[model samples]
Target: MVLSSPTWRERFRAGTVIPAHPLALTEQRKLDERHQRALTRYYLAAGAGGVAVGVHTTQFEIRDPRIGLYEPVLALAAEELRASDAIRVAGVCGNTAQAAREAQIARDLKYHAALLNLVALADSSIAEVVAHVRAIGEIMPIIGFYLQPAVGGQYFPVEFWRAFAEIESVIGIKIAPFNRYATQDVLRGVAESGRSHEIALYTGNDDHIVLDLLSGYHFSGCDLQIRGGLLGHWSVWTSCAVELHRQVRQAVESGKLVDPKWLLRNAEVTDMNAALFDVGHHFHGCIAGINEVLRRQGLLAGRWCLNPAEDLSGGQAQELDRVIATYPHLVDDQFVKQNLDTWLS
Candidate 1:
């Protein structure tokens, strides 16, 4: 569906009532265009909040770079994400085995896009990455990543980024490393260039989105691909939390809902997600938590994934239950319910 965030002009176009259905995705190209437009508006709109969807690569493996494809399990995850309006879904792959599969998964599943990293590809050279991008571009949208080694040993040079961004199919960039200067430099370059509007600089700096946005320093930097507002546990928490924030922020800005009132309602749910970050082995725990939350609300069968098994343990699930009990508002139950109705009908 063509899901444009309801802006003031959009609201005026919408008039008194907002249609339940946004737009039809009769053709795949239209769907792609809609996703691109949505990404642009969400990042550039004043106070707009955008989210990058997360996926695990344990289930999928990209054995060869020439032909982009993944295992069946990865395909399943991508399929589920494609059906959701929560946010843009990208393969959050690990090591070399699965890294090659990300671009393939993005294409095979018809996913809106994916976040590419060294671990995801296992080949860090700009030349290799450029070739990978060229091949993947024929498949789906690719969001380039530059992460610090300590933050997961994912790093790509500024020159590499400049080269990658030069590609038309490359839609966005996620700056994951904590180095503020480098992020600023890259953003400054993007802004100075004529293509600022077409590309996005996503703040991978989880703790600093608000600071960067409010700062007088303006560059092509826009949007956030984070775990809500919580950054402690990144892998699993980033996209989900960011999704909640985007939905809450959009509702308030659209005048379809009031702030602080429903705003508190959204946070109440996000708090449960935030609490997951504090749990041990938070990366795995957080992904486990997402499925736990989903299963509790009957969204999924259970939390399941392949090796380095990031799935939550039984005890963590118990803790998640406790958190949910204390804060029932954390589930986005109403939104879930509405979608369920549509799906079942």
Candidate 2:
């Protein structure tokens, strides 16, 4: 039973808490195939609507010439998720040829779409970026990304997104511009392009996940809203993230919106993200912090990143410890621990 691109977009809007996957590694920094399967199985059982690999959470380590982990990681995840009903999105970056090749590889491996991270071509003009996206669209549908600058975010204009939205191959977007103004700009373009319904809007806004999901926008005579989340923060405590999405979706369906209890929970999640991301350290500690939680659950052996220097910041471990202690229920470590052996098997 193969799923088409549109089926994948429907899943994206249907509360698919697509957490960007962190590459699992052995202590020796080699790809851990066992852990990779474990992570995919965990997300599937946890009810993640989809899973994204080769993204920021997976680290740029895959791209390093010396390590060259890109192929193995995606291949492993694709094999693990080959039968999944959930959407499979592989991150695509670099210049047009590189991105096109990545998209081709993902298609060959049966991924449904590309989470197009146009960040690598930071200096490329709007036309160049559009050209790059158009080239990859030849291979698969694109989930356009507006990543934050702390991680080499691109400053794409509304005009650029308007053109992108008009393209038949651009089926979804992860709006992580990480700025209210920039996010609205993309929304306006989508609305104006008269393709709001065609393009699934997934928020990567970790700071405003609740608001982004619940708040409906009025732009260009079109009503627009974020469908779900594709977040790095959701990588940890995945089942809880799925539950949170269910709660939020229930709220949206109920019509009596703005429930105070859910609002508080959202803020709590943000605070936990601040700790997990190590906001004080400019998010340099984020991936390690996620792995740290997985490590404790026995899903991973260590917080080992491909880059030697990519470990946590000075107080990141302490910050993670504090967050875990403070929000014991939020971590959902018990659920993973209970199913750890099963998922590993």
Candidate 3:
């Protein structure tokens, strides 16, 4: 079941906020089913266009045979998305064989596409990597991921992206290399591929959300824009993220000079991400930081992760507190407060 329908393609291309769904764990490090469901409901209520489950924010350890959570988490989110026309993306990693199995699972659950993480093939050549991607594309539509190297991602040059864009099943690319030059390489490659119009561009660069959405790239005679975001930073204060995305989209579509205030807000949003993503500690506490905010908002019970050693880095909580206190306009605590009960129920 390929998600090649014009309606789905048009909606994805139009751009919308897609939160990288985080895992909700019990105090014992077990899956918190109720809170898990609530998180999906919260994303939908907060006006997210979609939720990306089994992704980095959900914790890669979920695929561990001992933990066995990959399917259940994807299923929970799928259940919630059934009533909506929201795009469903399941994060699939590993080599071709493992990724194929994962893609089959997501396909069975009705996911619209696979956000293919290539970290597992760090040592493989670009040609080998493309082969892996092609194998999985046979099972479902693909959304190529360019995860930042700071977190298990490998560097791929413009050639790799050009080949990736050429894949017939690829419908989008999430550019999150976190470096301006690398981001441009992706834009150039996709533009050079001549398939830019067919592949939607999404900013996974949490640190540069506003500017990415607001900026346009002209390469190989093709003008490219980041249509939306698929971010972990978005999972916490989602209602505000939705509004921010709307404003950015409007500015981009209008093709006029953006107000200076939007540029200022970009730095503010980056600062917020720095705190929540544990930038000071090399992102050692990134996942916990996201959970900490949700915990404070009552959306999560605690900041527990699958690995016991994974918890907030020292001063990370202080940073989160500082950002939350300083950026009341960027948080959705009040929004969550109003509908927490319904979501929890």
What TM-score goes with each of the models?
Answer: 0.54, 0.96, 0.98
CA lDDT of 283 in candidate 1? 45
Q: Model 1 lDDT vs. the true structure?
A: 0.45
Separate clash counts for every candidate: 8, 0, 0
The digit string of per-residue lDDT tens for model 1 on 1-345 reads: 898776432222121111001111112212222322332222222122323333222222223333222433334343434433333335545544344455565556555566665565655576876777766666666666666554354555556666777777776666556577777656654554445555655545433533332233454454321212212222222233445455643553464434455545434544554455323454445544654554454334444432235557557767776775786543445544444433323
Ranking by lDDT: 3, 2, 1
RMSD of each: 10.4, 2.4, 2.6
Return whichever of 1 and 3 wins on TM-score: 3
Model 2 over residues 241-339: C-alpha lDDT tens digits? 888888888888788948888778778888898888877999888888888888888888898988788778998888788878987767788899889
In angstroms, how far off is 338's CA in candidate 1?
A: 5.9
TM-score of 3: 0.98
In model 3, pairs of residues that clash are: none
Among the numbered candidates, top lDDT falls to 3
Give the Cα lDDT of each candidate: 0.45, 0.86, 0.94
| Candidate 2 segments whose C-alpha is farther than 4 A from its true place | 1-6
Quote the positional error of residue 325 for candidate 1 in Å: 5.7
TM-score for candidate 1, please give it: 0.54
- Measured by TM-score, the strongest candidate is 3
